[model samples]
Target: MTIRLIRGAAVAAAMVSGVAACSAPSGGSGGGESAYSVVIGVASEPDTLSPLLGYGKDGNSKIFDGLLARDADLKLRPALAKALPEVGDDGLTYTYTLRDGVEFSDGRPLTASDVVFTYETVLDEKTNNTARSELDAIKAVRADGDDKVAFTLKYPYAPFAGRTVLPIVPEHVAGDQDPNTGSFNTKPIGTGPYVLSAWSRGEKLTFKANPRYWGGAPKVKTVTMAIIEDDDVRATRLRSGDLDGAILPPNLAATYKNDSDESDSGKKTYVAKSYDFRAVTLPTENEVTGDRAIRQALDVAVDRQAMADKILDGAGRPAYGPLPIDDPWFTKDTERGQDLDKAKQILDRAGWKTGVDGVRAKDGQRATFVLRYPSGDKVREDHALAYASDAKKAGIDVKAESATWEVIEPRMKDDAVLAGGGSTGDPDFGLYTLLNSSLAGDGFNNMGRYDNPAVDKALDTGRRNQDEATRRAAYDMVQRELVKDPGYTFLTHIDHVYVLADRWRGLTTQLEPHEHGFASGPGWNIEDWQPKQ
Candidate 1:
């Protein structure tokens, strides 16, 4: 069956009239500089365009510039800000100086008021901000001057600077609107390289390069992101020359690598080891996964090496823990090898006896739980199937189920979820939200309800302390403790895949976060691109 591609006639009309019709060739077969528009075929679509809600998660950073952005090396770099914030009072306070002459896409000048409003709205109880917990430490945010802003924290939050990567919304437009259901989400106006030209929900969204952009207009005048949820379809579109670039799975991406006929195209597949790992979220409240022995047994029972080799097609590495092995905070002792005999012993000691059907039973409760993964995701599905097969060796009945995020979320507390996580430049980004006791029961944080006083203390040390050595030591302790009773069973760190048309040049990449290619993908610096001469 063929998927329908909705025609973006309105966006095309806008381009032809004036805005993006400047000086490029119009034909597609042989493109001129003006005809150098890119259509990206992606696996998922952004839930909203509102920065306050969830647009930032899936590489929508092109439409908005944060106070700070990460460099190629993932180091904090100034975007809207003139430089990094200055800390005082042992990190309790931070002062920022904004870059002069920055303006939103609507031509509204950016000021300290916009900065203050963005933070206040996030902290506001009335607004449903997904990132509310990330900014909870802020006691107050106020403008010191027209071009400056300052923040006072209730306590010294070590990851405060890193969290500043959040996109800054315009106060003039979003100040009075209900942040939860604002029109700005569908039609956003931000201080970024591109402007939202048109949005055809569930189909495609078109962007026009901002002529007045602070960093200057991007090279590709128009960009269209076609939402193709299926992995096979995204790869198919890339091969058919309908898509300029696409994020593909390892197996699909391998098909395009080193293609002699498609020499005009390119493919990149790399293991961004810094902060990409897939794992299963075993809810502690669930009866089947409540026992620490079950959690530990499942961790070792799953052959991580095989998953990395087979599922990822040798494009990834076995992940022993949340932090990648190369990460400075990673501890080697916590990494355990797959041992089926050991897994069975752990279940036996916990009074879980094998039943007639080969499933384990203990105290009238059977070792069975529905393992859910997002439907249409091939990678997550494969991991879920592999996990279920391995768990059977230890008499555990892990029923693999596929459903949308909407369905899986409500049932998360009662079932195991095959979730994708681990991002942000700091360890606190992953550890704090995933394991924090205070964030339990909330959909965004600690969904598994895996609360441990020892784990909490170690995470706090990393968040409360400012010194690098102290923070490093705290994270090391956290890895060591978690290995004993890991909250999530880490599977493998898969390498992100991308196939791009060779018509464009200057496509560089960095160590990507969990979600590939949006914020830090091959076209991240598309503004600096130059058509092949």
Candidate 2:
């Protein structure tokens, strides 16, 4: 039986486009030529600076440098470690050796003890990290010597290596401190390429290049991130040449692409590669969506292709289930197609008959549901509107509305939600966080209150399997089950769009998830970036 109980139901509900001019900084040295600084516009201010807390992408990427980082192709590469981990014969034990001479920004040498401290702290119940579930399989983490760290897991997890993407904290500072209740969460110390300089809450965050960075000093001396909630405002700032770069909304990308400003030498635009998926979550306990037939009907009613074309403006690819088609583990044989007739038939069989107003009704109750999305998010708004229109054909009433995250969180238990989340590589990374029943309240990304024994079993098998063939089969079963149940109406996978200054060179884009960061952008290879003469 599926455990449909909504964990932390009250908090479930809580949770951007356009490129404009690259505006010049307000009080900085004129645009003529000094040290290159990039001002980026983020949707929300980071919740905390500590990587252990797992809040915003900006804070996590700055304060913590992971042992491994994903590249543009979604391939894992060593960031702090010397190379990929070596797995033992049983695949439950892995070993990694740190690169020599790596040091924290504080000038202390990085040792295996730091890695052990970071992983153990996160796994310790005291940390309360949302990412704790990601480390559930790890039985032990310890230092082999000064530079080598070894992991012994309770099971062979295929995505265990991917979890290495998390940033490592210093053992000396975090020792004996409860990570869950520590003051260091606000002001963290990291070994990344940049160190936090100033944080003016609700306004901006400033960081300077870490001079002692083991990778080498970044050519870009400073990075400033501003929390710009308004898409138009972000676009305006970008086009005005006040900011070096900003992520563009799909609707505004066309406008920027069409702009024929021959006089401006600073005209620069970049379409970064991404694999983010967007979808609508159907609460399993909700009366209107409790039935599998009703959920499947809603899925069939959605015109995913149309939404990809009109709502996403061709910036997204149609998706039928949780796993993207590009993913190697995706189950291609599964069937997903537009069949309005079939959808209407299913709703009718489920006792949802069309009423006087053409909306479905059962037991004198209208089959109406509220679809909540974050206010001021253009992409979500567009997708919600499209879903509403498509559901109308099946006699289901979908009310699309905007609300602050504070208000939306409490209603997720009883209401449907327009939500989106995905990752770059390893199907386990995306599937386990979103589908595993254990992760509902953990915040690693289970937005929908969905649970199925088959899915759970498949996920468990996939994570524990050491062989590639077994892992692939397990993930394939998960995709098939997810598609059949239709817990979330999978819409499309969107491409990452960015507008950067012409002077900045060596911007490395990645096939990232919804969250954008320096780890996947120009900052990915900041050391290699040089001013274009």
Candidate 3:
């Protein structure tokens, strides 16, 4: 199998319970000479602040420092470590030297022991980190003297360097508590540019700049992330001056693009290319979806190009594979275009003939399946409807249903789901997790029980080999194989959009991962923002 990349410039276009006396607008600092603060509206609240559990974007909590961190250009740079880790002994070992005189927000010196504790804690069975698989390549982690840490891998994994970009918590604060039920998960202390000042559960969180931070205190003295679950409400707040900025959908963000009210406000709109892509996971165990012919037919039947233009409002691109088309590792040959005639032909060849009801039937089974999506998410709901409409053209019956995650989880093994997740770090991060058979029952990584031995081998080759040529060849094979018998119908890779006020300057965006708004998008380097004098 071979993969090909398609380079084309195409242009186009959350939840809450009541009962509490809604908390008053938190007015900590009113506008004045000392008011170097901004209120940011976010759609969802953080499940936890623990980095090990994948709390923040790219394993960054704004209060914690990782060994390596990416700059605005998505280039890996040293953060807690003084420099990039040294890979030695055939790429099996990684040695990192910690920065000198770094101190946690609690005034404790950071050492290699803290780094060891962070990794070892993640490896512990009792920790229950959702992203533990990211660190599974590491066989052992140890501290060398005071300022150095080392990692020994079971195999020579090429993406091991990027995986080391996880946060390193202070051993003195989080080492003794249960990771699942620790106070540190809520009130964390670290060496990042800010400190967690206050947390009003289910409402908002506050952060104050760390004056003693090694990277220098953030220019914006304070940040308040207000939890506003409704998309319209978030945009409304941004317009009402309640928020300095907020992550908005393309449709809503466009409203402020040329508004007269924002002309003199120094308001700016940012549209960032995101690595996140959404897909409909077709479970292989189900009789209807189990057939490779049915999967391929459905893949080509759905019009991803239309989804990007109509559903995304010109803020995304049609996704062919897991990697975004613009990504360096993306394969051009893997590009797939919608062809309804071909889809029908494939189904007919597979003995799926249209019955009197206009639905395809093969042997004793009907080409009918239930597709579920989270009820409140408008984008997913629209996508599900569009998919069902397209699948109908190929004589397939798709029932798009709205259900909560609780209901969707139990039925993932049997029903199809509209799912989305990916990152800007490495191809292995998304590929290995989504297709690996070992992760099928993990309840998160591999939602659909898609097991292909050939794909597993290709993914293994891509991860274990350090040579670029070998890795690219392996990934290319993996993409082609998936297109031939896909477990998912790739849809659109979204472009994260945000609107910002003119009061603060220097806010630059990077290619964001799946999680948006926090620690990403225009706020990727918010700590470096300066007041526009």
Candidate 4:
């Protein structure tokens, strides 16, 4: 599931939300204006605010509240629901009791009907949510009176409860308009602590505290996210006093390290370890990338260590596969260290002969291809360039180019893309759509059009099973299969860095996922953010 709109190179964990700007603390959150107002800079923004379209599907969406929300540890807790859902022993049913007296921002009573509507709409075939596949296990959702909701699953999906973080939408407000083009997409009302004040497309999104929020009014009266796409621009704005905080690349964030002492400056640096990974999509449709030997050679050709150090400024760890090496689910046996010699040998054995120019040629076909990264994203650009350099060492020529998603999307079938997407919860959250043969070439799910049936079977096993041993084994099989035939060259799992005004109290970092900006950032609990009184 590409940034959904950002597939944002942000966190797939926080995909449905984000947009930002930059400024210094100025002894006040918003330049000595309002002590509580804060401005943030994010690299991406949500495709739509509507949950039915997949926005806030992973929670942390400030404008909306889910039945459950994640704690700092990424554990699920009650949000709109009174407590955790009651699961039937069969694992095929989940029952949730709606919190009494809860109300949407519009003052409409929160009812079980609303929860039913939200899930049912997303499951509707007419719905355009790319994340629809994630909820495929659900057989039906019914409102048990006005206070309870029950979901019947087709199978016992292990991470289904975590999926309840999908923000509940107000049926009274959104049910009438077309689900895809509804005005609620822009002007949404929810039970969260904030209300969307305005959305200036491609510029910024402004939010104000919801005074009538069920969780109580937020202390931070106003929060504005300036949608600055370029890393350098975001850093420049943060330095110039246009933003209070911004998610910056490692290089940009390093400049602010000595802005003042650790506890002496008006601003502070925050680092969040994440599952977000930067990888090169090897389109099976391309002549150069389609070759199995070429894919295998390039996999080990790119030095993940060098990328972690030089390109990431040591802010990320080299990724051997989709899951971070440190993650519990990652298979230690699947790790592939860089072997430039082995890469060349593999290519040579496959008849990719080095020509006079040192570039590989097979049957008159040159080992040359274009690699596209989203424009304005410095991290991806640097990764693309570094990958090309590494490929060149193996007698492969990679031409790195920059373009917007509009230009890059259509060309994904033939061109390699520096793609960014990751998840924090279940392996199926990220890997399923990424490698499934069925989703090949479906929007940004499988951009390289990778089709591996063995991997697909493994993915299905991992996604459908409820047993921990069974699921773990399935994922292990998936990672192991990638070791032999990787569809994409995964590079690093980044630790997102942010610079924020030190004036706010109770601000902390959580383990983040691929979708970012707002959902996974320190401001994720903006409702709980208190002024430094």
Specify the highest-TM-score model's number: 4
C-alpha TM-scores of all predictions: 0.91, 0.91, 0.92, 0.95
Model 3 score (lDDT): 0.78
Poorest lDDT segment (10 consecutive residues) of candidate 3 = 1-10
Evaluate residue 2 in candidate 3 and report its C-alpha lDDT on the 0 to 100 scale: 4
lDDT of 2 by residue, 208-232 (tens): 8889988788877788876566667
Q: Give the top-scoring candidate (lDDT).
A: 4
Alpha carbon deviation, residue 210, candidate 1 (Å):
0.8
**lDDT per residue, candidate 3, 1-533, as tens digits?**
00000100000003445302233233422334323777777765665677755555264568888999887777789999999999999999999999999999889999999999988888787876756777778999999999999999998988787877787788898988888899987888888889888877656778889987989988887788777766677777677666777888788787765353645244578888987788988888999988999999999998999999999998999998788998888888788788999999999998999999999998889999999986656777889999999999999999999886667778989999888777667888878878888878565667778899999999888888899999999989888988987988889998888887756658777887666645667777877877766
Q: List the candidates ranked by TM-score, beginning with the highest.
A: 4, 3, 1, 2
Q: Which stretches in model 3 have alpha-carbon errors above 4 Å?
A: 1-14, 17-35, 258-266
lDDT score for candidate 1 against the true structure: 0.75
Q: What is the lDDT of residue 8 in candidate 2?
A: 16
Which residue pairs show backbone clashes in model 1? Answer: 24-34, 59-518, 59-519, 517-521
- lDDT per residue (tens digit) for residues 16-67 in model 1: 1221222222354355753468777766556567767745632237888878
lDDT of each: 0.75, 0.72, 0.78, 0.84
